[model samples]
Target: MTGLLVHSARLITANSPGDIRDDPTGWVRIRDGIVTATGTMEGWAPDGDEVVDASQIGGPGAIITSGLVDIHNHGGATFAFDGSIEEILQAVDAHAAHGVTRIVLSLVSAPPRALEAQLTRIAAARGEQPGILGAHLEGPYIDSDRCGAHDPAALHPPEAHELARLLATGVVQQVTLAPELTGGIEAVRQIVAAGSVAAIGHTGADAGTTLRAIDAGASLLTHTFNAMPPVHHRVPGPIGAAAADDRMILEIIADGSHVDRTIVRMLFAAAPGRVALVSDAMAAAAASDGEYLLGAQKVTVRDGLATLHGTSVLAGSTLTLDRALRNVVSWGIPLGAAIASATVVPARAIQRDDLGRLEVGCRGDLVIWDSALVPRAVWRDGVRIVADAVAHNRPLAAG
Candidate 1:
């Protein structure tokens, strides 16, 4: 890869608490798809390759942060997870423009045959799309009573053979199930043993069952507080279990409607660095409000509220990670904490140590945003993918 230089950036390193550093006259050097050096303008000058003027691109308010990582998202830009390769790529491109550099394609509840076909297709597309990290299976093993927005008829207990087949496709990275279901805790162990993340969600699992799953290697809570039982004084649910366990990562949909701002603040305070903000968004995101398909179900999105055609249950979110970040910040969360939820927390949840930070030896995926926290430019693997001067004035994407 060729080398490039980024100068005059307000750097927010999502490394530690209070690590926001502003060097109005600073610069970063990129070589071989890694950040080689960073420092102030005093002794910094482009020597080997391109010397791009970042201020000219993004103006004075250019803020540089790690590329956003979304470990769970069903679809975006009118593309559902069950679509063909071309449609998936189009969805990914739409999300890339919004600064989502890495994403795990989440699949809702479906039959074994349909699930297998989708996984096989996604596995085939893996090499062609670098941002397509892996697949998240969020179905086939959940509570029938709490299966909000999911086809309850498709719910079933985890079968080792079925899971083996999905894992054999080499595209299943994360699977969400209810621990209280038949064979659910054992399924968590099986998923972990297969080298994929196991998560608990869409269930009526009580605190005891939830913790047991965590002990059995279920490391994530899929969209906490949405489909699971609410936390009650007498009966603390999965949300409480996740909050109490430091090893578990909780996924929060911060679209302001799925969760309340006060609860968001509480979760940030309770979980600190373990919360990952996700856009559990469906096909309507980044597209106009209308009818969209998620798996076999039909959803209607009106005024940004997505719901199943005949039910009051929230279908999914219309949120993007940038909007989630903004909402968290608006809820009085510290900028660093909110940013970490969208970056480091999700990266760590997926066991990707090389992403979610702006530092030496890390993948050169990044986002440059203006003062309003709007994405100006995006980079993936040192390649420039999206650069909108009027929208995202920054130059270059990644390589």
Candidate 2:
């Protein structure tokens, strides 16, 4: 049995909710793409076909964490998920370079036929690539007035037949819909029945309506406070409603533009162990700034801020999970908590408990970070993907 061992660095991971463990001198062992054991260096014995000494690789504050999992992402590297399989792979590789090991390909609002076609392609592609977790439908059933960068013309009320057809594709892991539509609550139930996550997003639903969706089994709040209404002391909108519930995992786009970082900190406090940081990125992510397409809308990304071509409405984001991890840590979030938000929290949000943590039986996916929180190396399925930084000169100063 081939194995790989990494030791002599900090191991920060959450085994269960509020059960984060941070070991100063820890190690993890992987065999055949699955973590086989983990503990402090004291228990280490001779093992593994290959070994890495983390202290020699990453400087003083080197840390090892599970590979980041992004549940809400449209596209990156000048390619959108709505394109052909080749383009989708290109986007996946682009994010992989930035340390995202597992990701859900998000598709913006489009006609039912177009969405179905894209979903079918993703289903086929998932077989060829284990990293392609599945698809997240950000909508065709949402409020037009709150449609951020989605084409209002492409929006529609949820139809049971239409949803059944989409879920039948078997690749739709999550569906984001406005739960206040004519049949919204039933749609939530139907989505839950199909074994998919029903998330409330791109909606104008107030607290009462949002609570009803929660009752019907909607477990996620999509990019809280972006396209939806703000938290008013009087109204306590969807953000307010979802924050109060322990069952709901609130998705936050921590990029500086989408929501204020100060507000993001508040959300973490409001919903401890319940927030999942996501890169709601479009094609502009990991690519040079320029014109891009998010669904049917034209977007212009300048200085890394993406928005509708002629309007101030944010299209998606230019964030990657690695950068998101750094952003929150800079905002006073403890490193362990921030890492959980990017990894374990998102995986649990979609019911994929096996993908995001460092434990026996979890996938062998992780990132090695320097003291500055910059990823120095990435490994997936017990194989090194990024080149080892130890082979180079002493680490360069992080910006």
Candidate that would win on lDDT: 2
- Expressed as tens digits, the lDDT of each residue in 1-399 for candidate 1 is 568777777767665423445456666677888888777765677677577666666677777777899998988888987789888888778788888999999999999989999998777767789999999999889889888888988999898898888888889999999889888988999999989999999989999999899999989999989988898888888999899998899999988888888998898898888999999979888777889888888898887788999777789877777878877887899877888888888998998878887777888887887777788888887777888622322211110
TM-scores of the models, in the given order? 0.94, 0.96
The per-residue C-alpha lDDT of model 2 at residue 252 equals 95
lDDT per model, in order?
0.83, 0.89
The residue-by-residue lDDT of candidate 2 on 28-63, one tens digit each, is: 998899999999967786554588877777779899
How many steric overlaps are in each model, in order? 11, 0
